[model samples]
Target: MSDLTPDRTADPTGSAGVESKGGDRAQYGMCAGLAGLGVLLLVDAARLAPVQSSNDALGPKPVPIVLGVLLLVVALFYAIDIWRGGVGAAEEGEDVDLSAGSDFKTVGLLVVVFGVGAALIAPLGWVIAGSLLFWGCAFALGNRHHIRGLAIGVAISLITFYAFAIGLGVNLPAGILDGIL
Candidate 1:
């Protein structure tokens, strides 16, 4: 039999042995968090000013309302599943070594890179700061081709900057390249 198959012999009642033990109580916290977030979203959506125009009739309220309702539904189903002792199955194909230690050096480097990138955003602009962030992350992850990585990073940053600032009509600080861009 496959590892995924439950052992019926362990429980004559035909339910998972966990049901008798009262299931996992820890998962209830996730359900409660989801429900709370759903309520918050609903409340926020309710507070939005009604917008009626010829171009757009629906406004921004529908999306948040739908999302909030979906979250609540998902939370209810998750709580029910948890009450029935339906725990998630363990991954069969995972190759992680549980005994191995975490690579803190890489993590620390990435964190520092992110912090520097955030600090430089207003001064250097999205293009320069984002390029540095991308290249720094690549270097942290062991990319050896510095010039290629930098070029790719610049391209990505420019694309995102144009996409968000011009295409999507979101304002991004132009910083040093304020007039040129």
Candidate 2:
């Protein structure tokens, strides 16, 4: 029998039948990255001021601390799994054509749109600039309905503007609509 063929007599499940030459070492990089991110989060979270109020109890430390610990635990488990000769399964049910080249035209258009949005932000403001950005992105991605795209973009931008300004207390530039906004 060929080395590539699984030994059906060894195990019915076929998992332990075909021995991998060596477990994938690439997964260890992900484990390291997760651990690094966890450490960074813990450090950053530690730097936050422990300010407590009647309305906001527990401050801003618990969430990051919990997330950091969770990440560390996950990283540890992932590393252990990798050590046990675990390999990721191949993706299934996708109809992607791997041979097709990237569509640079759409990418270039999106870059231009993003640049234009950034340039317009200071002069036209977040609402208008964001609307243009959203619409332009949709157009670049092949959305043909100009009026509908524009309306949707406007609504999204307006909602985000209000959400950031009112909900988060972060002031996005009002620009031309300074007094009105």
Candidate 3:
């Protein structure tokens, strides 16, 4: 059989050494998860029996359909990558660490932060909850600028709150700030 090993010093696809499989698994996993989520969304959309609710402009179909289509596109790309033997340019013999200690820590912190933020957002209101999310993320990501980070986080939270809550007129739970917002 012809050697499957790509030359180490040479570009694999003849492109300018543009890609690596370093995070291909992660990307694939994300895509798979998204595709699964899309399937769920599509199912839910199908099950959506129209009912009279306070909010009745756009039915449940729109968001779910949009999400499903987008997710399907992402899934297609990921599957293509897998079919192409991943995005790795390294030779067949070359080895790399797909999982690292820092990666675990980062992923763990992200899960915790998202879980806590989602749980707290309703009870704490957007501003406070968002501030917590922002500051917590900066800390988790090993940001060094303590005050600056916090400031930036708070600013982001406020801006996001204003844009989504105020500008878009989307109804987000006020939680603690129910009367405050």
List TM-scores for all candidates, in order. 0.79, 0.79, 0.50
lDDT ranking from best candidate downward: 1, 2, 3
Clashing pairs in 1: none
Kindly report which residue pairs in candidate 3 clash with one another.
none
Candidate 2 C-alpha lDDT tens digits along 21-48: 4345777899999999999999999999
- lDDT per residue for candidate 1 within 24-118, as digits (tens), equals 78889999999999999999999999997877889999999999999999999999888877777643547888668999999999999999999
lDDT of 3 by residue, 116-163 (tens): 998898888877888888888888889878888778877987788778
Write down the worst ten-residue block by lDDT for model 1: 13-22
> How far out, in Å, is residue 19 in model 3?
22
Candidate 3 Cα deviation (angstroms), residue 22: 27
> Considering summed lDDT, which 10 consecutive residues are worst modelled in model 2?
10-19
Whose lDDT is greatest here? Answer: 1
- Prediction RMSDs, each to the true structure: 5.3, 4.9, 8.1
